[model samples]
Target: MGIQHVGEIAVWASARDGNADAFAELFDLHRDRVFRHALRLVRSQHDAEDITAAAFLELWRRRDAVRVVEDSVIAWLLVTTNNVARNVSRSRSRHQALIDRLPRGMYQGEGAFDAVDAHIDAEHRETTMRGALAQLSIADQNVITLCVVEELGAAEAAAALGIPIGTVKSRLSRAKARLARLAGDARAAVSTTGGAL
Candidate 1:
């Protein structure tokens, strides 16, 4: 076996035996990819780091169950990253709703909105795309994250999501439609505000 395979086998054995060092080694090897996956889903560096750490914590806690599979640790990381990212999204959505419901002038500051505005323009259109994606259903969000953001094929996304490939295609189609509507709305809002100014 090559170095990676040998390392994976060793880590698997040590993890099965509940060795922290082995788990740490596994974490070190997978952390960057895991963080990137989390970043792609969560869309915030801080949240992504937190999610990645939480995922690794769960993996460490469930070390015995984390064996060397065909995709090795990367697949496990993706699964964990997805779950944690959804949790983070839910929390943020709830918090934002509460903030939105607050009386105007109760909370003061355009700082956050200003920051978002700064990221606008064609060069940062990906940020706009991500914002539009946030308006999608949770299921659609998962499908888009796996298939589009993560660049997994429909069949692979279906396997990851425990659904049929057809289902993945259907969800992605709806997600794209919803994303387009949301993007249009965002653009309209920006245009109206600019006209007012």
Candidate 2:
């Protein structure tokens, strides 16, 4: 093993032994990577930040169960990020449904209306990407996030996901095709609607 691997093992061991400073060091070392992975999975900066925080919180909560792979806790963080993103997405969907059920006139103030419009416009692309990802199976989404978005090799992704390399390859292929089709359909919809809504 390299020097960095040895260092990581030491850090992980310290953190596992309830060393708060060591755990914070681990967080500082990996926060950006975890945040970026969360961003890709969730597609909203704010939500990604939330997911990143939640992932770390989960890491602390599950410290006893933490499984380090290849001398790093990143694999565990990525998996936790995925799970947190799913929960956040589900909660957002439920909240939106509740909002939609509210009487329209209840939200009809001019400031509220303008704010809603601006928020929707700002989130259009994120919404589109999220929709595209939603079209994929959870397994496919996980593969795409690990292999494509995070640029992990097939072997590494398989290790992270506990799947066979062949399965990662096949799932990535299908996920890519599905994302392409979804993008095409989104573009067609935009053109059909003359870029409105």
Candidate 3:
């Protein structure tokens, strides 16, 4: 193993031994990467920060079960970030559904302001993209997040995913094609309605 990898593994080992300084060192090493992955998926700074925190907290909580693909803890941290993002998305969907069921007039006021067309369009596109992503199988989503979004190498992604490299390659290709098609269809549907639900 490379010196850097060896050092990282050592740091994790220290953290596992209840060394606060070592744990802090590990967090400092990985905080930005974990946060960036979360931001890419969630597109919100605040939510992404929460996801990052949760992932690290889970890393500490489940230190014994941590997987070290390529002799690094990054893969595990990234996967945990994905899981946390999924949970956040699910909770948001549930809240939105509940709000949709409520009387719309209840939240409207006499001075309620309408969003600009650009803002409306942006929200429409984001919703469309989210819908498209939601349609993918969890496996497809995970592969895409690692190989496509995070730009991890195919072998590394395979290791993290616990799948063969060829499987990661093929799944990534298929997932990208499917996502593009689904996003296009979603966009078309939204445009036909003039960005309104």
Candidate 4:
């Protein structure tokens, strides 16, 4: 629909044909989005970088299997990122358990921890949303991620997911409602606990 997407499609085709420059172009175009999505899932900058790299590696490794939805590879990349993040999270669980046991400084550096009320509120909302999204069924999470997080069109999301457009739209709607309910319940529970995490 946009010129960038047209360029992206051409670049992807070239990359699939073993063009190094085109592959780099694809990586440059998508790295930030993939990284941001990873950051949301993992909540760690370094882990997000690893997840983003792994997703792109999978893209090249599985190029023939990658699907282009709505003249773009973003849906495939993002879904792959999600899967990669999950796997990484699972594998890192033991390592993270040890890491958590290690002592860390308490907001020692300036700007390390923002004490602003607005910042805290935004952080809380983000945390609650991440928690709620994690609680959703995989199907619901897929629809929500494709349709809402990545802003894929219903038709595009349907194609990416191999479902009808109507199904994608309906599932997105229901998933959004469920997510909102979960967030509300979380808020209520936190408030009842005197805002304790």
Candidate 5:
């Protein structure tokens, strides 16, 4: 094996043996990548940070069970990040539902409205894009997140997802088409409602 591969294996071995510094090194190496992938899924920096943290926590918790690929644990971290993001999304939706059901004016006025108008507009666009992504099946979402958003090669995505490359390609194709359709529908709706919705 190459020198880098040997070094990575040593790190993994140390991490598996409960070496905190070694694990921290691994975390430092992959945290930004995990955060970026989480952001692509959640579209909020705060939420992405939470997901990234959770993924690393999970990595430590399941260190012994991790499957190292290509002399690195990044693939496992990515898969765990995806799962964590999904859970965070579900929990956020449930919390939002509860908040929505609360009677209006019960919470008083403008608690977190200190954000600037431009920031609000950017947040709205991000929410709209996330909503469009939400319309796809979870499988399609995973495929698109890995292949399109994360820009992983089809083979890499297939390996990360534990599926055949052909499956990744087909799902990615369908996801792209679905996203396009969803975007078009959103535009039509906006035009029909004169941007009211």
Candidate 6:
């Protein structure tokens, strides 16, 4: 059998025998996608790696509850990764600290004035943006993160966040408003600088 067949069989067998090799094969099959998904949510490479490891470990822990259809390991990984990512978010003090560290200037797009400066400025702005995003309510943030950042769209975001489509829409609206207010303040600051110039 190909890797696809191997994955399904391994998951099925691992579910019964607690076979570490079977679990390892499953991890090999899905780790990259899972890591990328976690990275998108966690926004730190190190955290993403940890989340990926933890997710696979958790999958192995609950192997019996896992069901598989042919080559559908990615779906299973996505679900597990989502759960692990949320837990990682809840547990990480450094994640909260990053939010607190969002510099006021970065949001205003005011870090530097030259080409190299602009590149550095963009990095800081991203950091600040992620930090600000982390400050929103988890429900609101998850909506925007899944729909906008992850490009998951309305229905997919709802599934990932485990809410009704209407709830997803409601939360997304609130998140956008909060994000706009944040961006607006940044723009006003930029304009004030322009006026001074």
The predictions' CA RMSDs to the true structure, in order, are 4.4, 3.2, 3.7, 4.8, 3.4, 7.6
Tens-digit per-residue lDDT, 25-91, candidate 3: 8898899999988876675689999999999999999998888877678888988988898899889
For each candidate, give its TM-score against the true structure. 0.68, 0.84, 0.81, 0.79, 0.80, 0.55
Candidate 1: tens digits of C-alpha lDDT, residues 27-67: 77889988987776655688889999999988878766653
Considering summed lDDT, which 10 consecutive residues are worst modelled in model 4? 106-115
CA displacement after TM-score superposition, residue 159 of candidate 1 (Å): 2.3
Model 4: per-residue Cα lDDT at residue 66: 91
True lDDT of residue 9, candidate 3: 84
| TM-score for predicted model 3 compared with the true structure | 0.81
Question: What residue runs in model 6 are displaced by over 4 Å at the alpha carbon?
Answer: 2-22, 40-44, 62-122, 183-197
lDDT of each: 0.73, 0.80, 0.82, 0.82, 0.78, 0.65
Off by over 4 Å in 1: 1-3, 7-17, 41-44, 62-69, 93-124, 195-197
TM-score, candidate 2, is 0.84
Question: Which model, 4 or 6, shows the larger lDDT?
Answer: 4
lDDT of 1 at 114: 60
Candidate 5 clashing pairs, residues 3+ apart or interchain: none
Residue pairs in collision within model 3: none
Where does model 4 exceed 4 Å of error? 1-6, 92-122
Model 2 per-residue lDDT tens digits across residues 1-197: 33255587788788889988888888888999999888876656888999999999999889888877677788778878878888898898898798789987765575886676567656566666767886777788788877887787898888878889999998899899998899678767876886623
As a whole number from 0 to 100, the lDDT of residue 179 in candidate 3 is 95
Show pairs that collide, candidate 2.
none
Q: Write the per-residue lDDT of candidate 5 for residues 9-47, one digit (tens) a residue.
A: 788788889998888888878899999878877857898
Candidate closest to the true structure, highest TM-score: 2
Q: Kindly report which residue pairs in candidate 1 clash with one another.
A: none
